[model samples]
Target: MRSIAIRLQELDDDELEDFVDIWLHNRSALYYRTERLGKTSDKGRDVVGFVTDQLHEGDWDLYQCKRKTRGSKLGVGEALKELGKVFYHHLKGEYATLPRKYVFVSPRGITGPLQTLLLNKEKLRTALVDQWDETCRTGITRNEEVPLSNVIRTVIDAYDFTRITYLTGTLLAKETDAGPALSKVLNLVPDEAPEAEAPETVCEVEMVYLDQLREIYGETSGLAFTTINDVLAHPVHAGHLQLQRTRFFEAAAFDRFHRDNTAPGAMETFKKDIFHTVIEVYRESHPSRLDRVNAVMKHIGMTQVSLLGRMSRPPVRQGMCHHLATDGRLRWTR
Candidate 1:
């Protein structure tokens, strides 16, 4: 919450408008457009969103942002003044229609008297009329003294006071849940618990050897070794295969950690290192099976087969390797 308050304090008018846009967008499905009126002639609104699902075809929700211009807190005078602009504009038809919701967003918040007035919907019109001369009448117009005319009074009286809403910096921060997407923009960590580690997506390492073992057994027994399933389904390897599944998940967790934290160019470097490790392990475990490694790499899309020497196969293709790493099937460090 402190982080959100600090972030709000740092935003200028443009940034605050954007913050409102993002916050509103994250919290609902209503599409939002910002600064519909140019910076100089916006009346009182900064961000506007449609209330219904049909995009621009619905009732409008106007969001007016009032940051602390020179004061420590936004007082009643300031709150009433901005609200007056909205009311004035709606009377003048600057807004095609009165907004269904008129929201005020500020870091300093509304003054205590105004806060109380806000709680009682029925009294808002009377309060605004009573305070209009000092708080809003002369303040709203620039050229001539636009006093609280009978027309303005009628508009204010007929206006729905229930449409008014206030959002302080702390309240907005508590309600907004865009998580890292928002946090990244603000350069702050999200106010949520860390996520649990996820397992990787690749196939198990031992499963890679199962086919070769089936071939060997078939050749020895003088039977057609068409599938590793036939050999591995035997009760003998069933326990060992189950153990290999555990290893696969362990490999997945390690890959997930690396992918989560790996910097941009570092992933390429890591892949190269893992490929070399795969080569070294394959050499140690299946020295005569370099052909198998070559086949595996080719199957995964390592197209530069000519690069493979008479002795060694190239590692898996970079894209495929990353995919495997992401899946948790490919682990280099056993």
Candidate 2:
């Protein structure tokens, strides 16, 4: 397996920030809104996660991204300057409140000096004050030299140093492993299909698909298959009915599992892909409605859809046609 660290090494500064943006979406309960404050003198925020609806005016957490080269790490000089920008902008009223958390994000992480300061809040605060002139003064703004006055000193002294922290490349790579963006950023392995068991009897929700199936059965056999019991009485049709219903339930389970694990609308996006893939086949001439159903089911096996790494299953592919049928997006008879 290729290490995620190697994958992280490939991204540039902007790409790293973009990944951070995608990563933040996983924390929905903690942050109501998340935004990437990209290049353009962004007041020190590379990425922001706003916990409240009040946005920057209220509580927010800021991430300052640094994509360091291989074997190199972020130094205290660059880190302090970023901190200065956050406070300087706050002092200048760019935002009403200070960030609840000030995080330094880098591919290689921070150097020992910065890491030491971060662990000790008092030392971190003292280091910021001491390094203010050398690191932060001229670096914060291109124009004027920011003098560390009493007001600025007061803000620094009062501000919480514990909020300052960092995330190493290795830690970040581990995080991306769990979310939907993992495949987007790095190569993801496919999952195996599970056994899909059908229910003993027909359920209300399966009616739409079963209804379509009944019509196809009646059209082919020339028998009045009016009810679920009527279809169950036929040995041949009953066996086919069980298999089709299993496919439907397998797809339902697939959808439910992905909804819980993958990104928003992941299953829906896959469903749409499957619909477009087989819609042309559904429109084509077939011998009978039952043949049409079988043709669509067969088409899915050969056709490609954007399969989620976790939801890659044979039954899932077959079930999507039934799902589309239930949704009225595809008619097996027509």
Candidate 3:
């Protein structure tokens, strides 16, 4: 799966909220009895869900879900303010039954300062303890007397913000937490190194090839050709020749010879003798007249014009052979 950071960046505001709703739904049983009640009187409350238990007659819990990027921390002030809105809704007869519990959910988790605030705030503290107690009785153990901040941290520690959000939604609908299951499926080790970085720009590979080409041939010679094949075939001014380049030249020569000649059964004989010689020279240079042989063969169309019966050739035939040798350009070589 792609990183949470990457996925979060792709989602818009509404998508993010929907994502949070889904994540909370999947990861926590607390969301099982809750139904998303839509927008609250407070803008801070992105989602309002009513929680009911068998023991309680009506709404037992109220949840305020907040979604943010990983590494971000939500403060106590935000938690308190959200709680106050829930309380306000209760007082105004909006939820006449009045929720017995209040909960805050954040993707990034809550800040340390917020945790302290929750601990100190009498009403908020009671609501959290009560919620924790009820959840514990139902075999859903609260890992700790965690504040809203700690809850956020736990989610972040176990899964990335995006995955946590995704899990929440899955849990809500299925009554199952997908995070732990996903962790097992992924089989990720905590200490493993992250994946290798992707190349930042498109031109990087091309630039590297150009640099290597220039190092083998002179910089001036490297820039003289437009096609990659031309650059590959050019002799390396450097002492050592690349094995890769040598193989390329032989392959290119073999293809060119067959392509230029229209004569039937020409390639069969040519491949046996001339092609064999070309391949040998391409591997290791022979000292005497070997360079001259290569130059001459390249000067004429190596495979195109064989030492055939005729001493005289037509103008167009001569031009075509010459063009094949010089890569379709008039040769200046003496």
Number of colliding residue pairs in each model? 9, 0, 14
Q: What clash pairs does model 2 have?
A: none
Task: Give the per-residue lDDT of model 2 (tens digit) for 130-216.
Answer: 999999889999989997889999999999888888887787767733455454455443344355678897889889889888888
What lDDT score is found at residue 181 in candidate 2? 49
Tens-digit lDDT track for model 1 on 148-254?
A: 88988888888889998788767766663543223434645322122222223324544444444455455545667566556556565444434334433443443
Error of 3 at 229 (Å): 72
* Candidate 3, superposed: residue stretches over 4 Å from native: 1-13, 23-34, 38-45, 48-57, 68-71, 119-176, 179-334
Ranking by lDDT: 2, 1, 3
* Backbone steric clashes in candidate 3, count: 14
Give stretches of model 2 more than 4 Å off. 176-178, 187-211, 214-238, 252-273, 285-288, 302-312
Give each model a TM-score.
Answer: 0.58, 0.80, 0.31
Query: Which ten contiguous residues of candidate 2 have the minimum total lDDT?
Result: 184-193
Cand. 3 TM to true fold: 0.31
What TM value does model 2 have? 0.80
lDDT of 2 at 329: 90
- Per-residue lDDT, model 2, residue 305, is 65
